[model samples]
Target: MIQPFIRVDGPAAALPEENVDTDIIYPARFLLITARLGLGPYAFHDRRFRADGTEVAEFVLNRPEWREAPILVAGANFGSGSSREQAVWALLGRGIRCVIAPSFGEIFQANCYRNGVLPITLPPAQVAALSAAAAAAHPFAVDLEAGTVTVAGRPPIPFSVDLERRLALLNGWDETATLLNAYGADIGTFEERHRRHQPWLFEGENDA
Candidate 1:
């Protein structure tokens, strides 16, 4: 079962560039690995470090204070590119629980929710404000239940998520589990009807 996501409170890191594709989030080379574990160290590998194995000092994630920040405030069209689920896995592996942006790539946004990560879309101005606030070491609290993002000295910013996705996240149910929970009785009834209407289908099983 997926873990429920209700709220997250922590310092935020900023990636202000637009159209950060999946390759940048988790490079293609790392896609060979099937396991999600240990992908954290490879998240933003090229941007976070250089060929000599030295950390890039200018990258926000490389900053001493923001290294472990759990929230990310980014620019518009974040997660653009191929639909690589590993991108979300990489972020989660690195302890990022929430990403606030003006917009996100279609598949990437869905993948975020499926993986128990909150991807909040807000007005461009509001996203920029959050990015600035994070740069100054301000902490952010995101409440999925309330649909609000709160930073000190600013009014709470409201956002939207699909109702079904919100419920799934709140209940820790993946797609298959959500479907079963919602239509268990109907499924059972259908099964019984099939058994009665298609007894021949099950005849060979009894003989075996």
Candidate 2:
């Protein structure tokens, strides 16, 4: 199950590169990975490490101050490309709960919601400000309930998320769970109607 995402308070990192796709987030070679928990090392694998497996000291995340950062300030069109949920898994594996950007791949943003990660879309200037704040190695606050991001030396930056999505993040409910919680009665009504109209479909369902 996804963890409740009321707020996240911690250091943040910056990735100013635009158009960083799913393959860049979680390389294609590791597509064999099926589990969600251990993909952290694979997030930005190529950019974060050398071919010989040594850490790329210059990469934002590899630096001592930003390593293990939980919030990421990214460039435009982040997570563009194939609809790979694994990409989100990779960030989650690395302990990243939030990514702030100007724009994102639609499917990737949806995947982020389903997996309990918040993808905050802000104007380019605000994102740049956050990225600069991130570079200072200071902690940032991402409050889902308040719909704001708190960076040092500035007013809380406001954001907007759909109502259903906001509740899903706060309550840690996956898509199916959220839908059921919202429409369980309606679904039951339909099922009852179906059973009445097509008794043959339920003929053996009640048998022990």
Candidate 3:
């Protein structure tokens, strides 16, 4: 199971470009590795490094102060491409615990929650404001329980998440765990009822 996401307090990195797909986040060349460890160095591989392997000086993540930021303030439609769980793995590998954006690809957003990354969706104006604040090298605080993003000079910004997703993140439960916790008793009762009503369905199991 992943770590629960309760609160994060740290510097924020800004990726202002829109429609950043999974391929951009964790280029397809690195997909062969099943283990999540060591994926951080390859995140944004093409955009962050030149062919000679030198870091791109202007890339937001390459900047001195933002290099280790734990929160990402991003643009609309972030994580827009293929439904690769590795994209979320790469970010988590890099220590990014939360991502704030105006919108996100549906599958990518789901994957984020499953892996303990909090993806917060706010209004466009709010996202832009947070991006600007992060660009200024300000630290931000994300409270999953409070549903607020707080920067020093601005008022706390509120964002919305589905109740189930929020609980999953707060409690560190993945999709399967969440479902089992929600319906385990009901499922067991149904199985017992079905067995009584259809004894012939179980008759061949003992005979073998």
Candidate 4:
């Protein structure tokens, strides 16, 4: 679960490219694991490390200052491939509480919610400006409640998330929990009706 709202403070860097798929975020080889173990070290597998197992200094995440980036300022259409929930888990596991991009893959955004990561959307220009500002200052702030991002002591810029998604993140509710809450009364009614129509299925009512 995530706190309703918290300010994110960390160095920010830009991916500055679109269609960043799950494999790039968490490689396919790392998949097939039940527990989210040892995944953080490999997050951004291709971009952060080379095939021979050496760091790619050019990648933003490979830098020492940006490794624990609490707020990720990225390009448009981030998280654009397979709907692997592990990607979200890997990100949250790595201490990245929030992602600020112009847009996100539909399924990937939902996955973020399930794993307690908040993905925010902003204008393309705004993302570029924030990325630049973050480079100047090691730590920046992303206020989930205020829906604002402040970098380099600049004025806050507003961002938005889907209303339903925002509500889920705020309450730390996943899809199953949300559905159960929405259908609580209906489920009770159905159970009562089932007992009446099929008394044999009810433990107490079926006694001979």
Q: Where is model 2 more than 4 Å wrong at Cα?
A: 184-208
Candidate 1 Cα misplacement greater than 4 A, ranges: 183-208
Clashes within 3 Å, all models in order: 0, 0, 0, 0
What Cα-based lDDT does every candidate model obtain?
0.90, 0.91, 0.91, 0.78
In candidate 2, residue 182 scores what lDDT? 86
User: How does model 4 fare in lDDT?
Assistant: 0.78
lDDT of 3: 0.91
Residue 166's lDDT within candidate 4 is 72
Q: After superposition, how far is residue 83 of candidate 2 from its true place, in Å?
A: 0.7
Q: Candidate 3, 70: how far from true, in Å?
A: 0.8
Sequence-dependent TM-score of model 1: 0.86
Alpha-carbon TM-score of each model against the true structure: 0.86, 0.87, 0.87, 0.82
The predicted structure with the larger TM-score, 2 or 4, is: 2
lDDT of 2 by residue, 56-106 (tens): 899999998888889999999999998989999999999999999999999
Which ranges in model 3 have alpha carbons more than 4 Å from their true place?
185-208
Q: Which run of 10 residues does model 1 get worst, by summed lDDT?
A: 199-208
RMSD, one per candidate, in order: 4.4, 3.8, 3.8, 5.0
Off by over 4 Å in 4: 1-5, 187-208
Error of 1 at 100 (Å): 0.6
**Clashes by residue pair, model 3:** none
